[model samples]
Target: MEKQFTLRKNEDFKRVYKKSKHYYNRDFTVLVKNNGVNRPRIGFSISKKVGKAHQRNKLKRRLRSIVYNNYRYINNVDIIIIPKKHTTDFTYDKLKSSLGHVLNKAFKEKKINYVK
Candidate 1:
């Protein structure tokens, strides 16, 4: 499937991290912000704290798969899924379950009448 969204730049990440509200549930952190578009774009952040470059990239690929699998149902806010320090040992099933629960919760907590 196509990458329906683009990752945010370091500057954009800083701006949103400062201004946007967030939620955390052990597995990931979801940051939501209105991009004034019809559909929201999503991004992921896997820091060096997670592991070495190999481990970090592996987790990044895993998280991207989670988002790609459900791209159609989710869209209109910039979302950044951060893999936690504990996620380095994540199994496929574990990651899937975590992504499903957290992604849904992020949307659930979002304002229903948000402007594009």
Candidate 2:
């Protein structure tokens, strides 16, 4: 993901965590907050409990790829994605579908709006 579309600061993540509405699925918990920007931004929070460093990095990469591919569907929100322990067992397709399901649900509920 581009730097401009990724949340890089601790404060930014904290703000989303504190003020955002949440959406969940078996593999991930997503926090969504209106950013009032022209584009969406995303952050990942993979804990040590999820796995070793390399595993966490791999998960982040996969998620970034998924978000990049689906960027056009997301609106102007700041999102923090927290992967559950079960995610370590997921293949890329599985993870992508799981995240997509939660995002679709969020959009349907109007918790997060979808762009064209």
Candidate 3:
């Protein structure tokens, strides 16, 4: 994801966590909030309990690729993704599908139109 499309500030993540509507599946918990911007912004919260530093970094990279690939289909919102502990064993495709499922569920309820 591009720098402008990423949530980098601590306050930004906190705001999304406290105020956004949440969606969950086995692999991920997604928080979504309208940001009143033209494009969407995303952040990932992978805790130390999930894995070691290298593993966490790798997971973030995979997620970033998935989001980047589907950027055009996303609405103008702030999204924070929290990967569950079970994801430590997930393959790239599994991770991608899991996140996609949660995102679709969240956006669908909000009446946001986006191509899958």
Candidate 4:
């Protein structure tokens, strides 16, 4: 992901976690907050509990790909995705579908306000 489309500062993540709405599943969790920007920004976190450094990095890549492919469907929010212990076990396709499912559900419930 591009730097402009990511949450880089510690404060940014903290602000999102403070009052952001969230969605959870066995594989991952998503926290979202209205950013008031024209486009959505995203961040990913994978702890050592999930796996070693390399495994975690691989999972991050898969998750980023899911976001990238679905970029148009998302809008104007800052989102953070945290993988669970078993997330690394999922194939890329499964991961993508699961993320999409959660995001769509949030939209349906009006948790994430759409832009355009």
Could you say which candidate leads in lDDT? Answer: 3
Task: Give the C-alpha lDDT of model 4.
Answer: 0.81
Candidate rank order under TM-score: 3, 2, 4, 1
User: What is the C-alpha local distance difference test score of candidate 1?
Assistant: 0.72
Q: C-alpha displacement of 100 in model 4, angstroms?
A: 1.4
* C-alpha lDDT of residue 91 in model 4: 91
Task: Give candidate 4's error at residue 15 in angstroms.
Answer: 0.2
Sorting all predicted structures by lDDT, with the top scorer first, yields: 3, 2, 4, 1
Give the higher-lDDT candidate: 2 or 3: 3
- Please, what is the TM-score per model? 0.82, 0.91, 0.92, 0.89
| Error in Å for residue 27 of model 4 | 1.3
- Residue pairs with colliding backbones in model 4 are none
| Alpha carbon RMSD to native, model 1 | 4.3
Clash pairs detected, candidate 1: 39-76, 40-76, 40-77
Candidate 2 lDDT over residue span 12-89, tens digit each: 998999999999887889899999999989999999999998899999899889889888676688988899987987
**TM-score of decoy 4:** 0.89
Better candidate number, 1 or 3, judged by lDDT: 3
Residue-wise C-alpha lDDT for candidate 4, range 1-116, written one tens digit per residue: 67788888999999999979998876668898999998888998778999988999899888887777666666778999888898788998788877777676567666553322
